[model samples]
Target: MSTGPGILAPVTALGAATLRLLGEMGAMFLFLADGLRLIFASPKQIPKILNQVFVIGSKSLFVILLIGVFTGMVLGLQGYYTLVKFGSEGLLGAAVALSLIRELGPVLTAIMVTGRAGSSMAAEIGVMRITDQIDALDVMDINPMAYLVSPRIAASLISFPLLTAVFDVVGILGGYVTGVTLLGINEGVYFYRIQTSVEMADITGGFMKSLLFAVIVATVSCYQGYFTHMRRDGVGPEGVSNSTTSAVVLSCVFVLVADYALTSFLL
Candidate 1:
């Protein structure tokens, strides 16, 4: 039999969880705003921002290529088979192009960067926090957010869209190879239909989504690192690892949720 306290325990737990979630959300909002402000404050951190952009954006190119190629090839192969069943295999080019430009390209590129650059950002910051490096900055009277966090956030915002564009181009090329060379589709029809079907709206909308996703990823990653605590009195390696995992998972979930919401509203 359930006692009164026992019954109340579940409700209490739920309330606590909800409060915690709201609190975290509020804190994260403030943190993100602070980071953004720090980005454009005096001295601009231009050098660091550019370096982070290169590291975060350029370093992920090979991984993007590998995934983008395979994803496009698979989309081509599967889309062709499905369309062929209705003798509309002629639409393969349009379908693949639409899929990449309108949705897959930006979403997958952000997810890939989340896994690669996002995790790295969290881990790097986590290590600094655990090692007392952040404290050292504070001791020197330096604002850590300006020096440490702002550049990363700005870099992500810039890198994600650029990387997504490359992913789109490469993905289209892969689809071309699969649909035309491998599947023996009519090449001229493919290009012509895609050129006609895909519009500027689709490309621009996807880029907008990528920009929003970048903010989510960078904010979550920086938050995880900046707040993660060590076991003894501060953070340890295990804490860093856990924070990194949390950042990546949360960023991915937020990306998907945002993607759905944006697609519904925009498309």
Candidate 2:
């Protein structure tokens, strides 16, 4: 009889945890819905959206360039040695280009953007939440979702695919530099194989993936910030910290998971 109580305790805790998680997900869905509705409800937010685009896209360019260059270089270096072993070094450019266009470029762009911009977004929102800035908007009859979040969400949707495209281009160029110059592969052969094998399909599919990932990153970051609450576990500044950390970690996890699903479906 006593054992029954002990067994039920863990089960009860598990059920409660599951419910809490489901509830949070439902709230986030509603948050997204509200943002979507308001984006059209208020078309006058164009300037804000454009500003966010600059912030999300232009500000992240240097990091994207840095990441793209190093990643492509490494891929080229490793890929060359491997292809050389198989006596297929001429295919190196195709291999590197396909890999970047199909996978690494979009995924890495999401990660870098999430780490830099996404965390800042969460922290900003978290601070707003903690300071009752959101409540101030409510008092002014302003829809904060439209004013604050929708612009960012829309901007991210635009920014991520563009950034991924940049990453793809830069990474391919880096791969060419390493494979052709340092690796002593024929420059003409390298570009020819890449141009021949790489297609519009690969580029389009990868862009689609980045667009979906952008939604995940922006939504998760904003949701965490908008809903930050003081609690015993962590609240106030602690809550902000927790929310920022959660936003980044969850964004990364969701991006990787979505990448797998998108890859499976698209490829």
Candidate 3:
């Protein structure tokens, strides 16, 4: 018996969607590869990379510090109460430190950067794409990937770890404020537990996650913006808007997924 058109239509659509997803993934991989290849091809890119570091890193500092501190404070409060129930309040430092250094610090930092700088990267590139500025670069014999994408990628590689370190340090201080200053946990005990419980491995793992998140955010944002002109959802300004939204959403999702995978491996 032959299948009806009704049955075939859904299958066809599903197939098309799958193919499109695969194609996009392939294109993204190539885009990242090309960008990475160009990142160190010329010494002149150092200035551009430094500029992006400022854009993606320095511009993001205040927000990261704010979030990190609040996150640590919350963790300290909750952990203190929870540990108190078990007569283990002294371990609060270890708990807070481990959580921040191993997970929250890197993850939150990445998400924040995605929300701030990732959106900017997408919108800027999408605008350029829509306005034919990318084409203008081509006509000028400039490598758009180098001139536009690589510096951002290189900057991300440098900036993420630094930002994550800042987040971790600030967060730890926040925890200390809540646990020691507010909750009456012994100050010496807090620092002692942290020093004893946190190892180099934990710090390294967090940095690794931050680095991975940086690449994910940069690549996804750039790829979406770079191809905004080809989006089926919209075009021109609307396309840029859609691309920016998608860039932030995808970057966050990928960060979480990568975190899980990395955590499993690191564990």
The model with the greatest TM-score is 3
Please provide, for model 1 over 1-267, each residue's C-alpha lDDT reduced to its tens digit, 9 standing for 90 to 100.
Answer: 657887788899999999989999999999999999999987769999999998899999999999998888998999999999999998988898889988999899999999999999999999999889999999999999999899999999999999898888888888889999999998999899899999999999989998999999999999999887732333598889889999999999999999999999996
Pairs clashing in candidate 3? none
For model 1, the local distance difference test gives: 0.91
Q: For residues 1-267, could you state the per-residue lDDT of candidate 3 as single tens digits? A: 987999889889999999998998899989999999999899999999999999999999999999999999999999999999999999999999999999999999999999999999999999999999999999999999999999999999999999999999999999999999998999999999999999999999999999899899999999999999999999999999999999999999989999999999999
lDDT of 3 at 28: 93
Which is superior by TM-score, 1 or 3?
Answer: 3
Stretches off by above 4 angstroms in model 3 are none
Model 2 agreement with the true structure over 71-94: per-residue lDDT tens digits: 999999999999999999999999
TM-score of each: 0.96, 0.96, 0.98
Count of residue pairs whose backbone atoms collide, per candidate: 2, 0, 0
TM-score-based ranking:
3, 2, 1
The Cα RMSD of model 1 versus the native structure comes to 2.0
Segments in model 1 whose C-alpha atoms lie over 4 Å from true places: 1-3, 230-234
Candidate 2 Cα errors over 4 Å, as ranges: 1-3, 230-232
Better of 2 and 3 by lDDT: 3
* Candidate 2 CA-lDDT value: 0.92
